[model samples]
Target: MRAELFDPRTEAVPAEWDKFLRDEGAPAAWDAGALAAVAWTSLRTVLLGVVADGGQAVALFCGDFGSPRRRNPVYSPVGGPGRPGVYFSRILMGFDEGFLFATHLDHAGRVAARRAFERALKARLGRRCLGVVYQNVSAAALPVMRTAARLCRPVSPNTVLVNRWQSMEEYFAGLPRDRRRRLRRTYADVDADSGLRVGAGVPAVDPVEAARLEQLTRLKHLSPGEVLVPLPSLYFERLNHRDGVRYFVHTDPATGALLSFDLSFEHAAGLVTTVTGSAAGAATGRGLYWDLYLREIEYAIERGVPRLEFGKGLVELKARFGCVTVPQYAVAAPL
Candidate 1:
């Protein structure tokens, strides 16, 4: 086995990386299609593990060896303990799953490929920068990541998902009577509120307005000294592409105030809400967050998405909406 490094800034993604990802049934974001969109952006480089047989890549990890930036504890910006090393996810993207492998690889083969990749990364980037971090791993990927890493567990930041529901009605009916009543009232209130409208599209929002909305949203989750990363305006603008990414914007019709927004990605037969924001007062006694969840559920049910992944936060609330809780672990492994 051999490891290969590709600097997206200066090199093209090897065909083997593409072939392996496809063979593994990796998500589109892990493929060249999405990687191409990010390779030129803020990303630093990518690492790949190749089989000895024909130099075909079987394992892949993408990240950057950049300065440590302030990231929320809820989401570590990169892979290490704030040192310069490769972070698996891009700055703009939140944790999906980490470390993609060819589907054909069994447990032993998967572990071997990871070890090989780690050694190559250490040789190329030096021992001080030899740590890999994977975030929001699923049950299927947990064992593989644990094969060569240290796992960190957090309490409330677990990903919540709803599966096996046939329709919105079926989903709503399964909720507790009180929760169901509250959701119905909230939906009605949002509908009747002439000042507010839920607009669906992939439009790029004004940066200033986006910042305002983000700030308001973060207030709900702020710890005393936590600093959240600032998302660039270009990041939102880039979502305008025809890919499965979509945004639902909440706005005030009269004042054009950006009340709230949700960014959802269609991946692996599921709808994942990657990010969301709401103005401080916008959600006051309005149940705006729950409404957003309901909207996502309806969208998923209509589109026949087998599951709706409401990414990490407010577990009890999400559970009340009929979403099962799943523990999300971040694994750190030293090269």
Candidate 2:
């Protein structure tokens, strides 16, 4: 019943922050509109509230992180311990030095929510610079965050586990039709090539310019970086300033030129392509990225959107339309 600091004029704290990250069960990007659009994780919009206590309601919530080159070993500011969901991605600044990435929190004992999140990170950054804050694993979360990161002791902490697909055509009819016929002959040879007019839109989304931030850093070398641009291009122009999101582009009507793109979000089934890009040298057609991913999966089934996640890696051209292969995990514990 302590810790506090959240305040964006605080009114609709997303129904108490999406019921405290869904009762802290841990996913859906830690609910409440992904902690209100991550704003480059300034300790999650400068939050610090942990409030609720005794009766329970207070597992954790912290803030005040840094980046004066985070001890300067290479560099990776790409968002903080990655929050907005399940849990475990520590930096408690005390001897516990936590970590529990990709955690589902394997069921067992809570151990008092692991000593109250390491006693609120050793009472806010103390006790021997407690670093590494990563824990939990998710095949759909709940193992009590791997028994509260082994009761906050010290060993085992490199985590990753948060990718699934229980439905969605059993995860796309489980592919292999010649990798779904080379992903439908690379988008039907980029849609029977004609001036390459493929379709889908959500570009310039929250983006300012520099040609859409160099076309999303050149679509991060498409698949070479394995879908990851999570927010930059000015956080997708700050989710295009409140509109939040939606991404699927492939234009070129005789010269408008834009070829291909994808970066969805309105999830639950229908808007979740995550990241995509293609051009086929701008016109000729080398499979215009499978005709902009089967016209963004037939525009996610004409918007009914019962399914269209396609988040993790390529998985043989997203299992060539039939699209299957659900096993999302990406651990990283060590602070």
Candidate 3:
């Protein structure tokens, strides 16, 4: 098997690359078009594939390499050995979630493809390439991933709320009495605040305001030694027009101010909440965050989406909202 890299920005994404993802039932986030829409200035995105002599794709994955001088530091909790920027030189798989499409291959085939892909990756990046990191790897894919990397360390779990209720009322009815009472009260409080209104639709946000709010949220939650790369307004601007992408915004009706926003993606697998931003000094007692979560949950229920993925972090808090944790790991190999 020989490995090849494709830059969607420079050329058309080979049809076979998307075909493999579709055949494997990958999420919409992995679609070629979606990948191409990613506009982070600090990272270079590429699609990698391992093809056999017969021209059949044996392995496929999406990767992003961080800028050398502008390296982003790893989160303290999951930061591996060495300094904060140890992972800066590595290629990140699938941005936030890791996925390798190679179910069609046998064990030996998977190994060969992985080796070839790694070799090609190192060759492409040369001395600057320290390794490749597969983040948020699920348990089911661990075996296959093990064939490629030596380090498999547990990180935060991906939180998911599986939708079983038919309506918002049903969802509330299923919760425990105390939890249910709290949620009902919270919703009531939010509704009573005539000044606050929440809406969900295509992103119609001012990029400058959105970026400022996003950075504020990041600062509030940032860990020590963690350096986050600032996403330009262009990043949000580019994603605004993508299909299956939606933004839920909390606004002050009287003043017409955007207080907070959450970005979600609708995919065949489920609706995934990817990014969120809240205005500085936003009132926490108003339950704006919970309201956003409820909006997401209600959206999934209305659309008949099977699951609502909340991504990682806040394990206990998400659990209180009936979200189950799916353990995730980082598989890293140094060259």
Which prediction has the highest lDDT against the true structure?
3
What C-alpha lDDT, on a 0 to 100 scale, does residue 318 get in candidate 2?
Answer: 51
> In lDDT terms, how accurate is model 3?
0.68
Off by over 4 Å in 3: 6-40, 43-59, 66-96, 100-112, 201-204, 254-256
> How far is 197's C-alpha from truth in model 3 (Å)?
2.0
| After superposition, candidate 1 runs with Cα above 4 Å error | 6-57, 63-92, 147-157, 200-208, 254-257
Query: Considering summed lDDT, which 10 consecutive residues are worst modelled in model 3?
Result: 84-93
In candidate 3 the C-alpha lDDT for residue 127 amounts to 55
Q: Per-residue alpha-carbon lDDT of model 3 for 1-335, expressed as tens digits?
A: 78776665556666667676667665445556545555233344444443443677666756665432434532221212322222221122122544455566776776677677777766665555566777777787677666443788898888999999899899999988988998888777878888888787555677777777888888887766666656566556656666666788888899878898887777677888877888876747578888888888888889899998887878887877799988887887786
TM-score of 1: 0.76
Candidates in order have lDDT scores of 0.63, 0.42, 0.68
What's the ranking of the predictions by lDDT, best on top?
Answer: 3, 1, 2
lDDT of 2 by residue, 27-144 (tens): 2323333333443433223233343444434444433333322222122222334322222343221111122221233233243444455455444444332342333233443334
The count of residue-pair clashes in candidate 1 stands at 1
